[model samples]
Target: MELAVRAPTSATVDDVEDVLEKKKQWILETLYGLVEQDDPPLDKEYLSSEKLLYNGRRYRLRVEESSVIEPELIFDGNRFDLLVPENDAINTRRKRQAVVDWYVTEATQKLPKRADDYIQKLGIDDIEIEVTTLQRRWGEYRPGHVSLHSRLILAPRKIQDYVVAHELAHFRHEEHSDAFWNTVGTLVPDYRERREWLRVKGSTLTV
Candidate 1:
């Protein structure tokens, strides 16, 4: 998070300034990279044609509002069909929540199936999976339970599997020692690529 420059004692002020100007592109890229790690959540108005991610694929959201109908969301393979109350035209929060809630609900139903695959592979049992909002990490592990960020459901299947494997590896090794990484590798050999993708793009996984 720190950026510094060095200059010889004999160098004039203009020389240092010139150095900064010459390297401005690099300095800006470096700063932008740092900011991207914790980039702000993706902002949306929940309107038609907007992009929504699920299982690592971008699908256009089609919003339909009605006065007498209940607000609901449906995924029909091609895109999301969002049915909302007529007031959603002026009040977007409710429409947005419908989408968020759908993701959590879907995550609860589907994500656990993936976790079960790994659990069997790792030969573990009685592990509960909770999909909820996680602030700082993609996944966290305790002794007998695994909590995944609901947003993680937005990632591709491989990426999601890597995270699950990562947390499950902690079961065998609490600390991130060499044995832990070796275990992770067994589950996800390309974890480096998946981890890097999440690091750079995790912030964008939002409704």
Candidate 2:
């Protein structure tokens, strides 16, 4: 971005600092240009000069006066750079896995007691809770196990309970028939509202 500056009359250091803060992008770009230039034979000498003036304010320009040095990117001669690129696929996968692990750990600690209570109240038997990250469903029930998506951690407590109850209902009905709806409604009368909330907010629960 270009910053247009008018002539300044007796501008102070504070005025230059203020303008620099406001035109940061322009200053950085100017600094980068100086760093990339070959004519200066860049040494340790760095300096800032007033490049322009606008509205009685001095627009200061920063010159690296030396090759750009990012300490984080420096490496021993024998070692390669370890910084992960933002767009790298493997880095993305690792970030997602880390999020899943965190959700699973938190949910396992928070949900077990609630799961046991609901199971007993519903008279369900031989059910195990397994937490995993899923793309679509919040909870699913097999013959003897309940698979809960790690995304459930993002839901409010009432909605989480509704999901657990919904799956528990599935243990008895096996399908989303009227009987299953009735069972879920018996446990959580606001099931429809909770389900709608999940549908609307599910996308925001990303890692």
Candidate 3:
């Protein structure tokens, strides 16, 4: 971790030293917290023994070699069977990307239908839904478009539904006011529970 401090242009070295001296405890605590983090997904190496969370269930990965075509990842309700192209090197980053591609493809197939279900239920039309990687947010909504984070496929099915409902609710009310939450509740009565689940476990949803 790099430490950077921004002070007023006219500030002296002594001023900066005094400020850092005062808040040293808070800074150390923050740095130590980051250093001690052990989030499995964030540190995934994509090895065969390393497991992945799909639809909120844990499954170990099994790698195999195939010469005919491209790499393919298959889910058989028990494990992830990945068929790597025989000529390609099964390096960590490549395997991780294969897993990420699988998640994006699965999200492409699944999220649209779920969003459409809510769309039909809410009688909202003309809102385009997209699946892609997002730097921070799980779902985004504008006037006529919504983009869902591809990594959201790692979440439970109910949580996925909540994200869709949350974005669709924005079609009616763009802000998180009571009226907006009421609309979301109308669409998904148990959204609060799913939202809570995300708050507690969402950070682990990574490739």
**Which number leads on TM-score?**
1
lDDT of 1 at 181: 80
TM-score of each: 0.78, 0.51, 0.76
- How would you encode candidate 3's per-residue C-alpha lDDT over 1-207 as one tens digit per residue? 357999999999999999998887566334322122334445777667778888888899888888736667889889998788886776777777778888889999888788877898889898889998775578878899998988778888888898899889988888666898899899889877777667657777766
* Model 2 ranges off by over 4 Å: 1-100
Give a tens-digit lDDT track for model 2, residues 1-207.
Answer: 244666487898789879877776555334322122223222221123422211112234332222322211212333212233343333334433433454467677776455776787788787788877654467767888887776566557776787788788878888566898898888889887776655555544433
Inter-residue clash pairs, candidate 3: none
Estimate, for each residue in 1-207, the C-alpha lDDT of model 1 and write its tens digit. 356778899999999999988887565334322225757565898889997899999999898876636567789988998887775444677777788888999888877777777788889887888887775677778988888878778889887898889888888888666798899998889887777777677667767
* Candidate 3 local lDDT, residue 93: 74
The backbone clash count of each candidate, in order, is 0, 4, 0
Runs off by more than 4 Å, candidate 3: 1-42, 68-70, 87-89
Worst 10 residues of 1 by lDDT: 27-36
